[model samples]
Target chain A: MNLDFSFFTLNIISNFIIKGLLFSIKLTLVTLVCGLIIGTMIAMMRLSKFKILNYPALGYVVLIRSLPFVMVILWVFILIPLVIGKSIGSENSAYITYIVFESAFYSEIMRSGIQSVKKEQMQAGYAVGLTYFQSMRYIILPQAFRNMLPVILTQTIVLFQDTSLVYAIGAYDLLKGFEIVSKNFNRPVEAYLIAAVVYFIICFSLSYGVKLTQRKVQIAK
Target chain B: MHYTFNWSFFFKSIGGKETYLTWLVTAWEWTLTISFFGFLVAFILGAIVGIFRTTNNKYLVTFGNIWTEIFRNIPLLVQIFLWYHVIPHFIPIINKAPRIVLVVMAIGLFTSSRVSENFKSGIQSLSIAQKHAGLALGLNTLQLYWYALLPQAIRIIIPTLTSEAMNIIKNSSVAFAISIAELTMFAMQAQEETARGIEIYLVVSVLYFISAFAVNLISQFIEHKIKIPNQTFVKQ
Candidate 1:
């Protein structure tokens, strides 16, 4: 019932919270780029006509989607080093894990985006004598990406929220910063309260942008 | 560095009383328990809050939006930490509450936002004339919703809610972060005791997939069984 806030100063905020925030942001951006790349490849695989190209991609998206993100994080952090015969560090493992895990989600989004491009567009590309990859690169991808940008952005918001999970692997994420402050100041209440508020503010603001983007995307369509 | 995969770790008793496989099964039971109870809370509260958001009253609508945004925006893990660490400090009685109870509450509150969003869209998607017709028929607000709205809205949202149901199962994994001894906890502990980290995590993930996929199949079965012939209102 009793709480104190005097321990929370700008110095502590800058030293711990801001540092952790930068890492979280870095993780999100890095994973978004890498995930989209791998995910696009997977999406193309799934969209291919041959079973060799398709089944593995579908299996991947299904399998990865089914497991919890926490399992993926912990599993990546713990098992990858043993498998690969070297220590990649928790942060690197985290980056790898998010890319692998998020690729499944992004691949689905990518599949839908690619499918949304009219079949006639691809035919038109063929008529123009462009190869399939060339047409995909030049024409369909642009429209597909435009169609699914809002969805990808929405997924990023989820990614931003998910970065807090690295705290379990003992990484210095935003939540980890709060944990340290709580441990240092002996004020779990203030530390966690501030954490919740900060997370809410960032996500809520981002969601407002998502809503705006949805409107714009709809209008553009 | 070299490693050989040990597929036989499940046979040996890690704790002397039970095999590591048994420990994982027990954790699976914990996960299902959290998902089941958490779904109960999420469904009831989310339905109510969803109703609030869609109501004619401005204050209720605002309160509902705030509730949805607050719960939805905050990471469930952060909320779990607050529930596990902070809430007990403020509410003295919650200190005595079971960890299972608090974890369930956290998951429930976290997921209710999504469920509420589903329900809000479900209700809003219905024809406005349904509401007008119910009022014209002299049904009060409660009767109008209960008789004229909820049944149809529920029907409309079965698929979305199916994902939400699976989501509760997935999200219940966060309970392990609070040391709930769930599937993830068993994976970590069993790995520490036995160096077969990959096998343990793989086995645990498969268990999660089986349950979530089972839910998916069952919902699909129900969706198939309950189809109104030629009604294209539901998604394929």
Candidate 2:
């Protein structure tokens, strides 16, 4: 029951833990870019005047948001082989599932951001002879992005924490790195405790930055 | 590549005792039980900490902030693993308790941080006028919160609370990591047994959606019923 720090040697960390941390960071960055792009598209669709565009986008967000991320990862891992006729490996599946799943949440944030932009702004764009898409791209989106940046950053911090779920499918994430090193050193408890502290410190510091930015954003408006 | 869709697997009997659907139903029952009790714990704990955050005492506010940060920052799966694997070795009483108890405790505490944040915002959204009114009536702090502040704040927060409730249900799936045999675990095992991964996961996804949707409906109903007339005047 003794807490042991000696289990975490420099050799084990550099060999095992660093690889997982790199993969986790890679996955988070990739998902953030892809999810935000797809989410912005979905948010635009949901806000469309045409019913043909909105309903399906609305349904996708609702359906995905309702299910657990772990379930989605498991579903993708099992179903991908059948769809593509070969296993894509857990790492690729983790990437695809997170991008798809996180898009739903990001879209919600984007939707609120887009809605917060004044209707008058779009009208003014039209008054100056700009197309709807052009107005959104040039005028509305920049302001909306400014308003929602803090929230988006906060959600990304959440996404970083969620990278731990990749372990459920045997994807090599930071948590998996700890698990392997712990097994090697026979100090599973200490390894997990250290992992928890690492996650906490990273998320806490990032969220503090988010809070500061949120206040500045509010002041700007 | 044509994958066979076994439509009858759900109703088909297993081991002459129960159908696959029955097993899924039982597993779903466990999911609901864990989420429901877990949310109850979160609501109570979150309410207390959230109130502490708004209190006059700086020490209590710091303590509440620390509780929220510690629980909120750690991923739920790691916390669940800690509770299941590490805590039992230290606290023999927890070791003696059933596995469900530990799972519930972990999930509950994990969710409490979000609930507290929502509660704090709800309280902060109220204006200084309400506080002045309560003090003008010569009410004590506890009485003021009980009769005047909380009722209105809870109403303002119903929408946020609904989403939190849904989140708790979705999060309970992580309980499967510790082998609690919840809906996610049931689906995983059933997929292995039947080789019908698509159908099994599809059904589980729908069940989760229905539970979350039901909470949404109930919350919307409560929100409609309790809405303040001319809310803008009171919003500040």
Which residue pairs collide in model 2, if any? none
The digit string of per-residue lDDT tens for model 2 on B1-236 reads 68777778898788788999899999999999999999998999998899899889999999999999999999999999788767776786887889899888988898888888988888888897898899999999999999888998898778888888999899999988888888999988888888888899989998998888888898898888888887642353
The 10-residue segment with the lowest total lDDT in model 1 chain A: A78-87
Model 1: per-residue lDDT, tens digit, A1-221? 66788889999999999988998999999999999989999999999999999999999998888889988888788767777878888888889999999999999999999999999999999999999999999999888888999999989999999999887687888999999999998888889999999999999999999899989999998
Q: How well is each residue in A54-149 modelled by candidate 2, as lDDT tens digits? A: 999999997788789999899889878988899999999999999999999999999999999999999999999999999999999999889999
Worst 10 residues of 2 chain B by lDDT: B227-236
Q: List runs of model 1 lying over 4 Å from the truth.
A: B1-3, B11-16, B232-236
The digit string of per-residue lDDT tens for model 1 on B1-236 reads: 56678888798976678988788888999999999999999999999999999999999999999999999999999999899888888787998988999999999999999999999999988888889999999999999999988887887898999999999999898887789988888887888888788888889989999999898899899878876676543223
Instruction: Assess the local accuracy of residue A46 in candidate 1 as a C-alpha lDDT between 0 and 100.
Output: 98
What residue runs in model 2 are displaced by over 4 Å at the alpha carbon?
B11-16, B224-234
